[model samples]
Target: MHLKNALQKYPRLIVRALVHPTGIFQQIRQERAGTVLAYGLVIVLFNLIMTVLAAVSGLTPELMLPMAIASVLTVCIGIFWLHLFVYGLGGRNGVGTTCRVAVVGLTPTALLGWIPGVALVGFLWSVLLLYLGLQELQDLSKARAVLALVLVFGLPLLLLALLAAAPGFSVAWASPGRVTWV
Candidate 1:
């Protein structure tokens, strides 16, 4: 009876919780997407500038190395953002949220020595947050809510990790010479 009343009163609560200002907080609580985009864009732009520098400087590899490093870092950041956007966060807050999530999620990739590990952690964190947000909308019990969060967020991350870590798994995209390792 209480459940029925709650559902009738909050008919659109679930939808509201997945969109706009009401849900925006849940969608973008961490600001991860923004950070990743900023870092990635700066790195890519810097690399483009350096490529021009290399050309004007007579095509020296030495001159290109720094730019190359910067570009690689940027791409890593972008990848992190992508991971978070796709796997960690889930909602219907529109394209702005989506883009922000994508960019921010990628920022961790820029760090050295712990790229994969950090990315994995970020991914997990994102999933957990998303799960919690969804559970809040569903009004489930604490234990069941946590379980729901795990199932909703965990399976996708597991699949993505597998794909990423798999041998011969490749995603091709074009970038400036400095951005491409091979």
Candidate 2:
């Protein structure tokens, strides 16, 4: 029922989800597990496409596979971490609900990620939507909601730092087919 409504209403929902997420918060709350997973898959596909395009534009094509893999992990695992952080901060939303909000909140990123300078607009847009979505969906105070948003956006940088600091960690493209990571 909710899925049918979401599918029928997705065109308008995407706009509301990106610009004024609170307007769509109730609709997202009505989503079930399958609908949420569908949203997740859409986000993942967007990330993959963006990464590939960035790679092809001479930004380390050799590392495209690793970058794509990392993006997927970040999307999936990061959502769980976000849920736990929100819960610990006294948020009452369930994991599924948070995941739904997160995925829907990423609509801007998915749509604008292909453009270089414009992509940053999508990133910042998603960040704002995620913050508002957290507040609305989790019934959180402003402070806790900001903290949750920080965790969601900051986790990627932390992971990158860890990977860069790992033992024998190095990546360089010596040539078209010769990439080194050691």
Candidate 3:
């Protein structure tokens, strides 16, 4: 589907995905990979713009490029793990199909990311979408799908926490009363 159509359908699709995920998954499965990629690219660009805006608002230059790259890479890696988890959970959807679901599921967050204080909303919404997507696309029990998402997202977050606590490491943006240390 085109971006306009996708945007127009966002609210309805979110409701449908939550209420009847199988139908949503079927719709996502039928999406062309190129269209999904286009949608994803828009997210990446929007993320970059947000990063730049943050920099303008006093975020350090040293963190700018890395943040931009990381923002995009996070989405790419998220898609990869999404596909892996679906397969591991015995879903027969191909990689492209999984990617499409992820892209569409994340669409709201991706589009609204520029607004301050909205990232959390987008994130929570995307999590719900992913949870539903896994259950519907994989034909999995809710518990199993939740476990899959935990592995896909939780592990990395836990790892990052451990690594952050280790040695002298600190996330630059997280410095107390400072925009960055570097």
Candidate 4:
């Protein structure tokens, strides 16, 4: 029932996320956790399918099973990490606000990441949404929001770049017809 309802509502949500994120994020902030999280899962599942079928090898449950598990884990962990940074940086709101941002502010990423060349574009768009959502939805001060974003996203990326350059440690993506050594 919830899946059906979320799916039904997603068309509007997608347009809103793309066209006017601040308003939609404000709306999402008021949503219940279950519904928001369900929508997050749906987006992840849909993007995964699109990536697999449209850009990579055809639908393979074996690959999907682990990807699904990892994607869910990433979302859940990202929510907690975001909340920690948000609240620590003086966001008086509860974790639910951060959860909403993670769930809905990333809509473009979950929607457009399947396209081979546009994933980065979608990710940047999502980052902008997240920054706006932090202010509009959580009522975070500009400085705090910026700090939180840096802590949540910038720090990890910096760490990854450093790790990639470290001796005897490498990070690479595995794709169809290409085996990456890490």
Highest lDDT model number: 4
Q: Relative to the true structure, how large is the alpha-carbon lDDT of every model?
A: 0.44, 0.75, 0.69, 0.78
- Model 4, position 26: C-alpha lDDT score: 65
List the candidate 2 regions with Cα displacement exceeding 4 Å. 1-7, 46-66, 155-179
Order of the predicted models by lDDT, top scorer first: 4, 2, 3, 1
Between 1 and 2, whose TM-score is larger?
2
Give each prediction's root-mean-square deviation over alpha carbons. Answer: 14.8, 3.9, 4.4, 3.6
Residue 167, model 4: lDDT of 97
Off by over 4 Å in 1: 1-36, 43-90, 112-182
Model 1: per-residue lDDT, tens digit, 23-110?
A: 5334444435544345446434544565556556756444345645565564455434433433334433444444443333232222
Q: Which residue pairs in candidate 3 have backbone atoms (N, alpha carbon, C) closer than 3 angstroms, thus clashing?
A: none
The Cα RMSD in angstroms, rounded to one decimal, for candidate 2 relative to the true structure is 3.9
| Span of 10 residues, lowest total lDDT, candidate 4 | 55-64
Top model by TM-score, which number? Answer: 4
lDDT of 4 by residue, 14-99 (tens): 88999987789767766778887777777888887776676345434334445545766887888889988888877767888788
Per-residue alpha-carbon lDDT of candidate 2 for residues 89-112, written as tens digits (9 for 90 to 100): 888868877887778767877777
Name the lDDT value of residue 92 in candidate 4: 69
Model 3: number of backbone collisions: 0
Query: Any runs in candidate 4 off by more than 4 Å, and if so which?
Result: 1-7, 55-69, 170-182
